[model samples]
Target: MSKILDAFLNENLQNLRDQGLYNEIDAVEGANGPVITINGKQLINLSSNNYLGLATNEELKQVAKDAIDRYGVGAGAVRTINGTMDLHVKLEEKLAEFKGTEAAISYQSGFNCNMAAISAVMDKNDAILSDQLNHASIIDGCRLSKAKIIAYNHSDMEDLRAKAKEAKESGLYNKIMVITDGVFSMDGDIAKLPEIVEIAKEFDLITYVDDAHGSGVTGKGKGTVKHFGLEKEIDFQIGTLSKAIGVVGGYVAGKKNLIDWLKVRSRPFLFSTAVTPGDVAAITRALQMIMDSTELHDKLWENGDYLKAGLKKLGFNIGASETPITPCIIGDEKLTQTFSRRLVEEGVYAKAIVFPTVPKGTGRVRNMPIASHTKEMLDNALAIYEKVGKELGVI
Candidate 1:
């Protein structure tokens, strides 16, 4: 550690290493798609969030290449300057239409989008009613806003309603907002948006939904907000282009005024260079693919159901997943890590996620089944899981 650096940094890292929590990242030799090549091994990749299999799509790649040829590699400066390209404006327009919102604003990344949007609307005098298991980005955004953060039990509408009523009655904040992930990334649990909308209406709370994993995978490929039929009610429909959208960047779709406010106030939007034309074009095309039909979405779900059933049949506790993301729940962290390592050794590329990504004792090997997976590939992976689970006595 540098002598001038904050003392707490190394202390926390040391604590993590002492607790056997330090992770060593594995590098993929080639691009990661349905299958990945790491360490000269082609493994059945069940660890990516490439839900619709668009991450490696030739169509998206060609679109990106075309944009690069036409617009160059970068957006010259921050958006307020000259960075806002025609593709950027077009992407935002397409995104708003895709999310059924009046207007939208793009960001450098999903993490920055959270930091930007939350603080843009919320402040020290405001309060944020956040879901307990929401993404770390959401947590950090709330912290940066300097808003009083009150966590409600995960997807517990009753708890949310009670907290909202109490916050309103207390008069502690100038404005109150409820923030949640449309679908939890780890457990793949869908948010109860209809109930949340009702609660938000009862309390007049500003509603925000980060649908990063939900877009192109839910609501017949529209998103979670559309799936729940609450498109107009959610004040902020946050999403990312990197995951299912198969590109880099994030955006917030909402009322024209809210987006207009964010454009002027959000620090990241003001400071960071805008998304490049290539990424913008790529993501716009990806959204078009999703909206065209449920072909890829259906294939993803088919693969998800097959893999979940196979793991359960092997006595591996696959958690309550409603989406393509499935977690084979393992009780111990070390054992879960070992299990994933063994799976890799056997040509399966599932990764283990433990606390504090998920609850303690609920450590899991999260699998992301993509539309690109063949039934034969799925069957092979299941056989490997059975072999590994039996060897580890985890079944």
Candidate 2:
């Protein structure tokens, strides 16, 4: 390696470590459920995105096994080539049904979905009105499109309306689109989609919603668009099969023309190999389960409420989260990392989130309470939290 490159790397690494912003990842020993093992130590897990605990569901496991036996593992090629298998087609159909859309298209992952969908539709001649706090993937996608990105304040409807009106009246771009996450994962706040839709209509802007964190947890498992009954109003309904569906892939559900266009124009779909047979089969089944009943969804909310109440009662600064994703706000980065480390030492596994993922100075330990967590687990975790909070002087 060149001396200049080595110096640059070393300087950056030291800076991150000195500022307490370097995140060290720990590997989970077993299934990422309510409890997990790291470094041979058992801890109550509040860090997983497995909102419904469906990742370890026995029935889904069996379904995946059967699919692997029948179709083997890989899809063999890219979609436009020879990789579009029957399982892929079936999953897309199910996605369309679940999102209440005319048709849908699947991608290798949620990040890929954004990268493909955004750039495929928008270009330098267009503009995208994005939320200030939208996910990184959306940001990268907009950049890839070479579109003029206008960021509105996070969930501030008036700001969005003002920006939309400006972009429309200016007539500087041929097409304009408004994009946001259905639920902001970091703060757990639901997007003002109803108000956003109203603004979009006033400005004649296209609407796009990425409901990665809201699919299995909101709108009776239909998602945030359905939460506000905007199924017909929104143009693009994007989501991940990993977070709530307990599988690995992403999709964009919309009108038939859009799906058809993506099939031909989206680079990821044309270039990337399709999702494996087992994962696709399991994703389809998981969507069916979410559609069939609200048992898991209801239980997840119950646990979320329980944990939030416990944390609040203990005097932790739990942010204003509308969904089950909880963040215990600790202002200083070093203290936040220390708080998370102490929790792990005491038998709870909540990870610290700091700069870049969220803004600087608003560091936090984000908790994800799922359906599988019992009263005992929550109570114990709460007890450990109180101890850590007191020791760290965070409460």
Candidate 3:
């Protein structure tokens, strides 16, 4: 308890409180599915990234339990050591097959995958053209790479092309890489990967797409690259096993050479412990199921459409979302927070997102429609939204 440290923390925390920026975390009492219990209250969940509802699937849970029985609970060590178990290998193989790539490499988490893969390939002598709306992980990875990061307008091809041309013609860097999220999570807009691929070719830039939010939600569960039929064109395809796959890990799918390079050079893979055998097994099975049938994917999209249509009909400003993610915009930050609080009080579990996460004055309550959410649940949620929106003068 240093006095100086205490004063600093107290000051910043008070500042956050005054600004209505401090987020209070709510714990779910049970499994976080379509409906979740929090603080002894049951509510329809609209704040999860579990696009396909595989996170609580009985089959995936059973597979994980079976794996635990066979291989124990832990990975024992890092991947470069004794931790590269059979399950891990199989999961990587399945990921490669799922992404239509030659090979794939797994990491402990999606954040680690970005931090490891980006810095491993690009160095200080390189320049990274990043999407202005890319994920925090991508931004941190680019920073770690020591590369000059040039941000282009969100999904703006012209901006990207101009930056790429300038970076190339300047000859100030040895290699240039273009990195982006396949699906911009906040807005739920799909990236223009086809145009980006063409630009990459025109400027000889290494293309990297982090498809964490896209897997199992787009391209019939293949991803944005596959959705656009440019699987072979992108140099790096990064994804998470946690989001739609219903497990916990991340991976990079690409050519054999890229996989080999990551295996040898990625510091996180070399230092951090590998994902558990159970997680690896469950993720592999999830991928298999996604590839086997499009039932969950279709259901997810159906629910998304239903929710979006309902919100629009109710007259909420549900921004330009191209996917299952829906955002009910409330321009003022305080009103946005109040709107989310009202929704929770009325049995909806959507969270309010404000500045820093999004631009100032564009605060919103983001809703994620999952495959497990039933018609009744969506209808009830919509009823609640209508009530809250009208009460708050939002509709």
Candidate 4:
């Protein structure tokens, strides 16, 4: 009830509203699949990160229910205590195998995984070379480590090499780490990991790749690192169970020594409650499925290509994306928001990305086409896009 606090919040919120930068959340009436119902209206969903469409897979749902029936609904304590159940242990094992690592450690969420893992290994005596376009979680994790954070140009390996060489030759830090996202989410661009790994070798830098968006989508579902067959070369490979795995939680997969060290030092694992039995069981099942078949992965890319081609045919400036994530560039924030709003009104559910999330004048409506989307749904969404794009003079 402090007046100053209230005024500060009110003023900032008002500023956001005045500039049309404030976002309003829409609640889905049922399961978040390729098609979702929002406020009594059915929409062709293109905003979700359900890349492989496993989030609503019937088999995964059944497995989760069975786990709940057998193990109850929650992890009773932090992982360092009695909460490290058989399910948790099994999930870690599956993660290690799925990622082609010696061992792995899990956390409650992807954000927490970064925060816990980075700070656990790197500190003030270390320096981290990060991508300028890396995810926000990586930035926060580097900050928490209290290390010297040096940012290289986005996906520019030359810039990264220069910074890496400079940092390595400085001889001021005990360790130097290079961290980047395997796939840039907002722009849907895969990172140049192969070149990065080669550079890391020349400098003896500890390499970390956060493959949150790449898991179950790239490398035939093994991820970006394995996509280039550098699985063993990268020191730390971080993944999330939430995105394409279609469940929840995050993990760090590496050597046994690294996993063992994380178990002893990661603050989130030591202090926060573990993922539930149902989540662990479901995640394990999902990984097993992803490893077994590439059907969903292929279907996902099919839809992505279908949608992108349609958008391009209609004269929309879809960005240069190498993944299933498609961004229709609008270039102006207000118009971009208007475009998204009109799309929703016309039964599409893609959202706009503007300043703070993406650089200014690069505003876009990002579309994530999953395996569950039918050709019919994509066609309808395209129809809506053509109508809105033309009306807004964007095409």
Candidate 5:
């Protein structure tokens, strides 16, 4: 390593320390569940994105174990060459059916899926209109595409329409695409896809929805596209298996041709090794669970409502979240960090999100409720919130 590079790293790290932003990683000793063991102590978990709680489901565990027994540990090669297995094909088919699409393609992760799909579609000749608060993967994908990325106000359809109109009238690019998260993970607000579709129709822009947060929580666990009943409207429907599906990988579901094109051209799929058989099997089982029963989904939402009510009752500014991702808004970054540490100390595991992840002044401790949490666990978590919030003057 270069001395200058080492010096830069040290300086940046020191700056983080000075600002009290350099946080130490905490280890979770046992399985990640509704309640977890961290630092050898059991705590009520409110900071996980495991919405359906299938991450620890017995059926998924069995499927994964069975696949491991059969296919062993790793996918030995990239998908373009010889890594395509029976499990891969079946998982893709199941995913396509789940999203109500003709075809689907998988990636190593949701982040990689964004990189693969966007850069494959839009390039130097095309421009992209991205929502102001879209996830970082989308932003990085846009930059890598070498496309002109014009950011529209978050969920502001009027602003998006105006930008789309201007981009179209200019005739500077062959195609214009608009991309947004189906649910803004930061605030849990649902995207106005109906209004978005109208603008896309008017402007003839290709529409993309990254529904990572909406896949297992909305549309009766189908996705945000189904949530809005826009099965045939949105061109690209992206989602992650990691969150609610309780597996690993990401996918793009769309018309047959779009998925076919991605399969051949997306760099990650072309170069990176495919997901292991165990992961593929687990996801397929998780999908079946979502389709066969709505029990977990119902439980997740109930817990969400319960937790949000509790937080609000304790006087925390839980933003306009329409879903389970609740934000206990603490104004200052340092205080937000402090609050998170205190919560962990109090045997709760909510995580703090500060500047650069969210807006500079809107740091918050985000709590995610899952189906696995019982009423008692939620009630206990609420009490911890009350104690921590009052002690920190955040209430």
Candidate 6:
């Protein structure tokens, strides 16, 4: 390696460590579920995106096994080049039905989904009005599009309206789109989609919503667009099969024309190999499960409310989360890291989230309570939180 590159890497590494901003990743010893094993120690897991605990569901596992036996391991090639299997077609059809859209298109992963979808539509001649706190994938996608990105304050409807009006009246761009996450993962707040739709209509801007975190947890498992009854109003609905769907892939559901265009124009779909048959089979089954009943969704909410109440009663600053995601706010970065470490030492696996993922000085330990987490598990985790909070002076 060059000396200059080595020096740059070393200096930045030291800086992050000194500031308590560097993340230390721990490997899970087994399947990521309500409980996890790290370094041979069992801990109640509150750090997963598995909101419905479907990742370990027996029925889905069996479905995936059967698919692998029938279709072999891989998709064999890219979608346009002979990788599009019968299972892939079926998954897309199921996605369209689930999202109540005319058609849908799947991608390798959620990150690639945004990277492909955003750049495929918008360009230097267009503009995108994005929320300040959208996921990093959306930010990168907007950048890749080469579109002029106008950011509005997080969920401030008036700010969005003002910006939309300004961008529209200026007429500097040929097309304009307003994009946001259906549920902001960091703060667990639902987007103001109703108000945003109203603004979009007033300005004649295209609407895009990435409901990665809201798919299995909101709107009776349909998602945030349905939560606000804007299914027909929104132009683009993007989602992940990885998180709530308990599989690995991403998709864009919309009118037939949008899907048709993406099939030809989206770079990821055109270039990348399709998802494996096993994952697709399992994803389709999981979507059906979510559509069939609200048992898992209801249980997830119950656990979320239970954990939030426990944290609040213990005097921890659990932020204003509308979904099953709970974030215990600890202002200082070092202290927040220490709080999380102490929790792990006491057998509760909640991870600290700091700068870059969130703003400086507003560090937190984000918790995800899922349906598979029993009352006993939550009570024990709460006890551990109390001990850690008192010891660390966080409460």
TM-score of every model? 0.97, 0.99, 0.99, 0.99, 0.98, 0.99
lDDT of 2 by residue, 82-156 (tens): 899999999999999999999999998999999999999999999999999999999999999999999999999
**In candidate 6, how many Å is residue 348 off?**
0.4
**Pick by lDDT: 3 or 6, better one:** 6
What would the TM-score be for candidate 4 when compared with the true structure? 0.99
Better candidate by TM-score, 1 or 3: 3
Q: Write the per-residue lDDT of candidate 4 for residues 1-395, one digit (tens) a residue.
A: 89999999999999877766888888899999999999999999999998988899999999999999998999899988899899999999999999999999999999999999999999999999999999999999999999999999998988989999999898999999999999899988999988999999999999999999999999999999999999889999998889999999999999999999999999999999999999999999999999999999999999999998999899988877999989999988889899999999999999988888888789899999999999999999999998988898998
> What would the per-residue lDDT of candidate 3 be over residues 1-395, giving only the tens digit for each residue?
99999999999999877777778899999998999999999999999999999999999999999999999999899988899998888888999999999999999899999999999999999999999999999999999999999999999999999999999999999999999999989989999999999999999999999999999999999999999999889999999988999888899999999999999999999999989989988999999999999999999999999999999999999889999999999888888889999999999999999888988889999999999999999999999999999999999
Candidate 5 versus truth, CA RMSD in Å, comes to 1.0
Residues 1-395 of candidate 6: C-alpha lDDT, one tens digit per residue: 99999999999999999999999999999999999999999999999999999999999999999999999899999999899999999999999999999999999999998999999999999999999999999999999999999999999999998998899889899999999999999989999999999999999999999999999889999999999888899999999999988889999999999999999999999998999999999999999999999999999999999999999999998888999899999989999999999999999999999998999999999999999999999999999999989988887
lDDT of each: 0.91, 0.95, 0.94, 0.93, 0.92, 0.95
Q: After superposing candidate 4 on the true structure, give the runs of residues whose Cα lies further than 4 Å from its correct spot.
A: none
Error of 3 at 40 (Å): 0.8
- Residue 35 of model 1, lDDT score: 83
- How many clashing pairs per prediction, in order? 0, 0, 0, 0, 0, 0
